[model samples]
Target: MSGTILEMKGICKSFPGVKALQDVDFDLRAGEVHALVGENGAGKSTLMKILSGVYRPDAGEIRLHSKVVSITSPLVAQAHGISIIHQERRLFPALSAAENVFAGRLPRTSAGLVDWERLNRQAKEYLDLLGFQPDVRTPVGELSVANQQLVEIAKALSMNPKIIIMDEPTAPLTDSETEQLFAIIRQLKARHVAVVYISHRLDELRQICDRVTILRDGRRVGHHLVAEVSNSEIVRAMVGREIVERFPKVVAPRGPLVLRVKDLSQKKRLKNISFEIHRGEVVGLAGLVGAGRTELARCLFGVDPFDQGEIEVAGEPRRIRSIQDALKAGIALAVEDRKRQGLVLSMSVRHNVTLASLEKISRLGWLRLGAEQEIVQKQVRDLAVKTPHIDQLVGNLSGGNQQKVVLAKWLAKQFDVLILDEPTIGIDVGSRVELYELINDLAKSGVGILLISSDLPEVLGMSDRILVMREGSLVADLERGEATQELIMQYATGSVDARVERCGR
Candidate 1:
């Protein structure tokens, strides 16, 4: 659309036991949305980190406006009119939304004190522009994940940047919220701003991006106009092969009931939620952002208490008061926020994997190192997790790999039911297929799975039956053959009346 506004030449970066990027070259044109896509650990984030001054390139040259410049720190990057909205929320949880939006650049009065009125007013302007309706004075910690993501976007826009990098910006947002974000991106493009959009959702590229650059194993592999390449071609380039089936759903033989919830009520969060997952079955829980899918999962997993409910595991009633109670009852939950609720980031991969199954790998309260290694190694290898060693910190691995470790933790244990919440949010297309296959395998092994996802296609493809939720209640339960994207939306958005079949129940 315009002349090149930024160029990165021969960029190379390395970490211990990893060559994160290898002589990668990327250029961004003004007034265009350029997409950077790759499998996790393929160096998509690494290259962007280098550009945003989060990491320095071992060998590279960065030019902005045709002039070489060194971005030594985040402040330096900001000074150069470059801003980034990270995949992870990087805000002070204790601070108000307005305060976080203008954290470093708050308005000050003549007396050198913070001008609270102007600071909030300016912050509200940006949030309002993005169609974010939350109060500006609310603490970020109190907001929903989608609202927190909007705050990150608002913070970046407040900088009045010439270039902005958004990493998986819509992962936590609803379909409506994602559309709003796209509209904002369009407006920014009209103002001659360049955007570096990174996401695992391939379908989004054709919708909002102008050009795409693909990376594989830390090297630039392919670059093309979004209009010229098909999604299948892009998938092939990113993974180095063709993915025959994106959702390889296996029709495992259903067995006796493994999990059942009766009259589950969590005050205003969940209302009379009732569902059943038989052994060797994948029951998809589909809903919009605030349709209470996650809340139901949390209630089942004991992360939050349910005011009134009856949980049955293998036809035996049980009271799950805590995580330990849930696990003891042969239930496991892989939460949506892997970094926070799922895995302990500071721990080694091996430790995190074995953390959930210590009893199986220990003797007399002493860890059996050999048994631990054996289990962790198998899980890591089976998941195809890219890691130098088991001792590598889970935080050092890519987001997708980190998620694999979370699943590995549960896999190492004996569980009759597995609850996976947004399991493929940030995973690449290739990795997502692998996860689907893994889900099939798990179901084949007689573990009932409750898959909670906002991804409609995934729900429709992998599920034996789809349960639609709306306003904290179960609205519709459609068989795999009867479920469609449009029908699911109608049920989720209350466009259709509740019509649930007693299939699983």
Candidate 2:
């Protein structure tokens, strides 16, 4: 490692009934990317929160250049040249990109008025430096999630901090966009700025990190150079066991068709989309960011009403124009944005897990608390959700645990068709493998699954069939053995051979 720039000793923090961190220690160098990785609720975020003043550690000593300092708030941390990019973006949707980037520290003219021209110009410079050139004057809400990630990075760069902490920075980024982020990280490193990179993706650590720190059950278990340890070693340290297969895709004869879509269309977003999901099979959706994959999912789940389409549920034509209709039709959707659309952060794990099937836990305007507890307890145990208690707030749980809660909510139902949008988006490798096995188990149990993800290998490994969406339309349909990474990418990018089929039937 290079010269030590910061260190934390005996860091400890606790919430009401949960001890998030306990005597944890960490250090950073002048020009190195240190990766912090662990399973959900393993105290990775808790430790970083303490360092960034989101939470004050119960016991810890922070020394910068060998001088002990106290950081009691986010402003104090910022004053000490520390800035953090949270995993969830905190931007004003109604504001423009430039306005979001230079929100708090806007330039002022000599007359004591805000200078819009200089603000947009400087924000554009940062955006271009990061290889993101969205219209600065446009509302950020209109931009894609990947572009919003770049804007978050631009906001961090405007801070001119000595240390930058990125939490799951590439969770929503595509392959090319991720590479652009790596380039920016390297540039920051060359300027002698320390970066604390946190993510669940192990391959990213191998490519961009210098040293890796492993956390499990709120304790530091291993710290080693990326070159000294194999990825398997880190996985073992994270989950306390070996994960042989990251994607446990099963191969079995599929049953009868459970869902069939014909000529599904929405205004400008989806066009002539058609597909089928059979019982005991997993169908993967592959496409670029704006290729209408999510739009199709929404249409199926009744989140977005399709302009024209024919949907067949278990050999019977059904009209699913709303959530109630979809639920009655034996269809469900575990949406892509877990934080925004799926789970309620202000609620408890117990409440969230039983949200979808509240009718089952209620009796004619009366509530059955005992039954709800039983149902939620089983789900927590099945999903291995790490929490002090079932009553713990969902917001306090880690990203992986929150996602599990979302799944638990839908799994509580008896739906025959399930649509999982980005099922394993930001989860750890161990959790990803567990989810793959879960999906396979569901399929084996005669449940049809529609899996959507941006990861190419994930789609190729777990899916029994792949459906390629391009420019709001279904472009290709390939069976598991017939599909290849290159072939899917070609179809997804809208440059494919004539051999690829354009229709589902």
lDDT per prediction? 0.89, 0.85
How many pairs of residues in model 2 come into backbone collision? 0
Instruction: Indicate the TM-score of model 1.
Output: 0.96
Write model 1 residue lDDT over 71-162, tens digit each, in one string. Answer: 99999999999999998779999999999999988999999999999988999999988788888999998988888999999999999899
lDDT of 2 at 104: 82
Candidate 2 is scored at a TM of: 0.93
> Which one wins on TM-score?
1
lDDT of 2: 0.85
Worst 10-residue lDDT window for candidate 2 reads 358-367
Residue 168 CA displacement from its true place in model 2, Å: 0.4
Scored against the true structure, residue 344 in model 1 reaches a CA lDDT of 78
Residue pairs in clash, model 2: none
